[model samples]
Target chain A: MVDTQWPVYEVFHQQARGEPHIHVGAVHAPDAEMALVMAKEQYCRRQACVNLWVAPATAILATEYQDGDMFEHATDKSYRESWGYKTPKTIKTSDEETSK
Target chain B: MATMETLQDLDAPLKSAVIDLLYRLADDAIIIGHRGSEWTGFAPILEEDIAFSSMAQDDMGHAHAFYQMLHELGEPDPDTNVFGRKLDQWKCASLVSLSSERDWAMSLVRKYFYDVAESLRLDSLAKGTLIPLAQLARKLSSEKKYHLMHGHMWMPRLGKGTSESHQLMQHAVDTLYPHALGMFESTDADSLLDQAGVCPQENDLQQRWVAEVDKILSEATLKVSVQSSPVYGGRVGEHPDDLATLLENMQLVYNLDPSAKW
Candidate 1:
C-alpha cells in the first residue's frame, strides 16, 4: 500500500435534470479538477448523473454528533411541523369562513 | 477524404486498413488495462487502489467497444479476440506490454506517457471519416479526458516530489521513453487511413504528443533525452517476453473455457 495518502474530496451528484446535488461519496485526489474527475469515474460510472461537485473534506464545516444540546429545544414547537395540525371538520358559512 | 461510414460501405483495402487500426487501439487498451489492474489492492493507499481499479475497468470497456466494432467488421467476438490468440498475434504497443512491477512511480510515468498518446489518437479518431468509429471515439474520448487528468495530476507530483520520488520518476521517464515512442510506430495501413481521413498519421500525432508531453515534463522540471532509440515492432505482432507473462496470467481463467459464460 502507498504510505502517503492524498487529500480527500467529498463528492456530490445530481441524479437527473432539475435534481439537487446530493452527497454520494468521497475519493482521494491531488487537486480539485482531478477530484471532480475521480468523483465522476468512481461515483457516477454505474448510474446516471447530470452533474457532479467536489470539495476538500477539510474545507467543510461540520457539526459533531456528540453536541446533542445544540439541537435540543426546551419548549414545544410542534406548530412548525405538519403533524402538529388537526383536521377541521367543516366551515360554518361562506361569509363566516371568509371573514377570518 | 472518403466518408467510410460502416464496414459494409468500405472497399476491401479500406476495410483491412480500418481493422488494423482497430486492432492496434483495442490491443493497447486491453494490455494496458491489465497492467493497471495489477496494482489493485497493492497501491500505497486504498483510494489509489480504487482509482486505478476503476480506471482499469474504463480501459477494458474502451477495449470492448473497439473489439465490438471489429466484430461488426467480421472479426471474432471480443472474448476470442482477447483470449483465443497467441502472444505474437497482438497489436499492442511495446510500452503497454512492459510490466510496471511494484514501483508506483514507474506505473504513473508509464501511464502518463500512454495517456497522452491515447488522448491525441482519440482526438484524431473523433474527427474520423468512419461514422461508427467516429461516434465511438467521441464517446470514449470523453471518458479518456479524466484519465488524462489522472496522469497530469500525478506526474507533476512525482516529478517534483521529494528526492527519492523525483529520482524514481526521472529514472522511469528515461527508461520508458523508448517504449513510449514505440507507441507511434507506423503501420503499413497508416497512409491509407490518413488518405481516407480515417485517422491521422502516426508521425503527425507523434509531433503533437511530443509537444504536449514536453510541456508537461518541462513544467515538472524533468529532462527528456533527445537521442534515444524507440523500441518498435509491437504493431506487427513482435513484443517483449513480458507480454507473454502478462497474457499467461490474464488469460489463465478464460483459457480454461473460452466458450464459458461468465
Candidate 2:
C-alpha cells in the first residue's frame, strides 16, 4: 500500500588501471550517493577495483541487437594493428641500403 | 586436548541436539534472507536496495553453509533442506517468518532485531565444542557485523527523516518488537547445549542484545516498550501462515520436477 521502493541504477566497475569499465550488475537506491555505496559493497567485496560508476538505468541510450550491424565497418582497418605498418620497415631497410 | 577429544566424540543425543540447533540457525537465515530478498528492486533508495540484497544473499549463504554441515551428518541436501521441508517442519525463529513486505521501516527494524540476536548467538557458537560448527560460527559472526552496521547506520537516519518516514519506522518497531523479542525463545535442547558447552547462557545473551539495541535506539531518540510475552513457535516448526506462502513461492520451480536437474 506504500510506495517505499527506490529507483534502479546500472553499475559499471573498472577492475584496474587502463581497464575498460564492465557492466557488473544493477542496484536500486533512493539517491546517487547511496547507489555508489551499495555498488561498492555488493560488487567489490571479493576483489580489487580501481573505480565504480553508477548511472540511472533509464538515462542510458542503447542500440538494439537488430540494429547492431549498422555500425559495422566495410573497410579493412589494418592500420589499427602493429603489423599493419610493414611499409615502414621496408622503407628503413631501403634507406640503409642506399646509405651503404 | 582432552576437552577437544571429548567434544570430538559427539554421542547420538548431542549429535541430534547439534543437528537441531543447526537446523534452527540455517532455517532462520534462509527464511529471513528470502523475505529480505523480496526488497531487491524495492528499497527506500537504490543504495539501500543493493545493500539489503547483498545482506540477504549473505544470510542465504550462511544458511547454505549450515546446511552443508547437516548434510555431512546424513541430513538432506541443501536444496531439499531448504525448499522440500513442509511448512510446519521449518525450525526458524518466528521473527523471520513474519510477512512485513512493502514496509521499509518494518523490514529495517526486523532486520536490526534479528541481526543483534544472530550476532550474539553466533558469538556463543564460536566457542562451541564441535570444531566444525565452531569454525563456521566464527566465520558467520564476521558477516553479521556488517549487517549490524548497516541497520545501525540507517535506523537513525530513517527514524528522524520526514514525519512520514519517522512515523513509519516507529510504527514498524512497535509492531515487530514482540516478535523480535521472540528471537530469544529457549530451544528445547538449550539444556543439552549448555551442558555440552555448545552455547552460552540464554539470559546473558538476551541481556547483551537488549543493552546493545537499547543504546542504539536511545541514541536515535527512539523508544520502544520491550514486549515480555514474545511469540514463540519457530523452533518447534509451528509458523505463521505467511511461511507457507513463502515456501510455496520459493519451491515452485524446484517442485515442478524434483527429480529433474535444472
- Number of the predicted model whose DockQ against the real structure is largest: 1
Off by over 4 Å in 2: A1-39, A49-100, B1-8, B226-228
Write one digit per residue (lDDT tens) for candidate 1, span A1-100.
5555778899999999899999998988778887876787678778999899999999999899999788998899999999998755554465577897
* Candidate 2 chain A: 10-residue stretch with minimal lDDT: A1-10
Top model number, TM-score? 1
lDDT of 1 by residue, B1-262 (tens): 6676666888899899999999999999998899999998898777667778888888999999999999999999999999888988999999999989888888888888988898888889889898888888889998788788888887877788788888999899898998999999999999999998889899899999889999989877788888768899999999999999999988899988877997
What lDDT, from 0 to 1, does candidate 1 have?
Answer: 0.88
Q: List clashing residue pairs in candidate 2.
A: A28-B46, A29-B45, A29-B46, A29-B47, A30-B45, A30-B46
DockQ of all candidate complexes: 0.52, 0.20
Please give, as one word, the docking class of candidate 2: incorrect
TM-score of chain A of each: 0.79, 0.65
User: If scored against the real structure, what TM-score would every candidate get?
Assistant: 0.89, 0.75
